[model samples]
Target: MNILVLKMGGSILAKLPTSFYQTIVALKQQKICEPIIVHGGGPEINETLKELHVESKFVDGLRVTTNEVLDVAEMVMSGSINKKIVANIQKQGGTAIGMSGVDGKTLQAIPIDNASTLGYVGQVKKVNVSWIEQIMEHGAIPVISPIGIDGSGERLNINGDMAAAAVAKALKAKLALISDIPGVMENVSGKEFVHEQLTKEEIEEKIASGVIYGGMIPKVRSALNGLSGGIKESVILNGLAPEDIKDYIQGKQAGTKVVMKKEEKQHV
Candidate 1:
């Protein structure tokens, strides 16, 4: 039951300096039970689409996916990003296993209805997280790729944040999102930080006011969902600073907290 689900976006993955092998090597020394990673390949997907002469469009902040786009998504996400992280962990003397959300029926989903044409994009409908425990039991890290399957056995491109949330809830874990920015900020500029803990509703208010929009919205919403669904707590932290991981894990305060329910908002 001592597990932390860490979700890192492709932005962070692509930004890893020199290589992430050393970081993973360092992390091996810091044993805090099991850590599972779920990752997205956003920038890589966009770049690949451009190379293939595919135009990109968004409907209400969600990507407008077509069958062609879905192929590219799977290639970049499950093929490139997923394998890369697994290799990094392996080179660091850690046992690493890469899997798409489809592997072993680990993740199942339904459509996200943002638009009728957003083909192949899905909202997480279920997560079978026994793989996480099984991997850790064998001394390996489960490095999840954000690709899922539906009831009809069709593939889906699940959002990494939602994917992580669902997996954390399934595993009954503490969710930690690793991002480029420092956690959620009340002010539009991340410079004005909200260092204290916050509630789901308060975070939603920030999203509505435009203080946090764009990508942060999905990340924040995932954190809230994780807590509401029985995961212990969820945090958004600067993955660039891996040293802070210990502090956040013990709830000593390092990132923006979104696990608190709406009723607890007044207390903060």
Candidate 2:
């Protein structure tokens, strides 16, 4: 089966229409592609932390995850947001199972900085592909939360994008990054237009020329990192326009496809 790993950010989850979930169910029912969802809960986590009087800190965009912060993150991501997504999919008449990386040791990880600087922040070192495949074969969508397990049996906070990329690489699946915007946009002359596809070279040029700046730079860099990490394909799709999901699956023009090299564009 062609597996499509859909990575949805917390900010866009509530804004996505019910049709989005419906489309996913339709795709699965039709056997178009097995849709595995990996989601983030940054906004919800922050809110919960504030409510619990926990101070949040960040170092270079990664949350400084003390044991207290890890508790809140896992509670929000694995407990709240994870089930919410499962319920939404079930509401759309689909069977969904929600789990965190710690479940079945799905995402085996190592701390990014030996748990010294970034606290419990870690990157995925390995993935349990068979576990996810078993879930998929059972005809259920697996909704994953980005909380990984370390070698010492401790749960570690993972970056959502990194977790999605690791799963995609392991499953040999296409990674679809669902965003609020259409895709990566570039300004030409004066007007701006979305690039239907971007290569590493082009992305670098855009970044250096200030075309891709601020928040987009990190997002594009993440896509590039995934490519380098063995993810076969990656695309940034607009979650707001859920119809694009089908369009993309049908090989129609949809979001911006990111590739490692220019020659790789033709095959996509």
Candidate 3:
């Protein structure tokens, strides 16, 4: 069975419309093995934090998770978003269970200061796939919230992209990031600018050449990390499009295919 780990970007999650659910329903008709959904709740998290009168900060895209902010993140991610995603899956005729990175110590972590300024955020140190596999084996999807446990047993909020990559690496699945736009654009000047396909090396070169910058840098970087982390392949794909999952699973070119040294088409 082929496992597919999907990371839903936070930018789209707060407003992930019914169309996204429809696409998951479509995947139900495919040959996909276990499809684990790892989701982000950035906008929602910020919104909730604001309502609670908490100020949020970030360094290198990771939220500065002080204890107060950590409380809110855990509530929003574990209690709110995870359930929402699982409910959507069930409504679409697929069974899914909402869980946290801490469930059965599924994802163990360590503090990631990436730079001296960042605080409390975690980088995945380990992932225990048993719980995830147990759920998947029962024909149930696991909706994972990126909240992990640190070295000292403290709970930490990890970045969704990094969390998804770690989970993909643990399962050695085909990882996919579902986003609002088409994949990485190459031509830049036209509508079809997005790469039909590209090797991770080619992608790095584009970033170095300043062709891909800003928001896209992280998106591509996350995809590359997933590929290098142990997944057979990974993608940056259009999340809102109808049946996007089915399209990519069938290699229909709906978004950018982040290659593994070479195209999967040439694989043995």
Task: Residues 2-109, candidate 2: write the lDDT tens digits.
Answer: 889999888889899898999999999999999999999999999999999999998877789999999999999999999999999999999999999999999999
lDDT per model vs. reference:
0.77, 0.90, 0.81
Residue range with the least summed lDDT across 10 consecutive positions in model 2: 259-268
Error of 2 at 20 (Å): 0.8
1-268: candidate 3 lDDT, tens digit per residue: 6777889977877556787776675564454556789988888889999999998887655678888998999999899888988888788887888999988899899887562555567878999888999987777888999999976789988888889989988887778888778788766446457777778778878899998898888888888878766676778887777476777777677788787687545556
Ranking by TM-score: 2, 3, 1
Off by over 4 Å in 3: 29-31, 113-116, 188-191, 208-210, 264-268
Candidate 2 whole-model C-alpha lDDT, 0 to 1: 0.90
- Clashing residue pairs, backbone N/CA/C < 3 A, model 3: 185-194
The number of residue pairs in model 3 that clash at the backbone is: 1
TM-score, candidate 2, is 0.95
Best by TM-score: 2
Error of 2 at 127 (Å): 0.7
- Give the better candidate number (1 or 3) by lDDT: 3
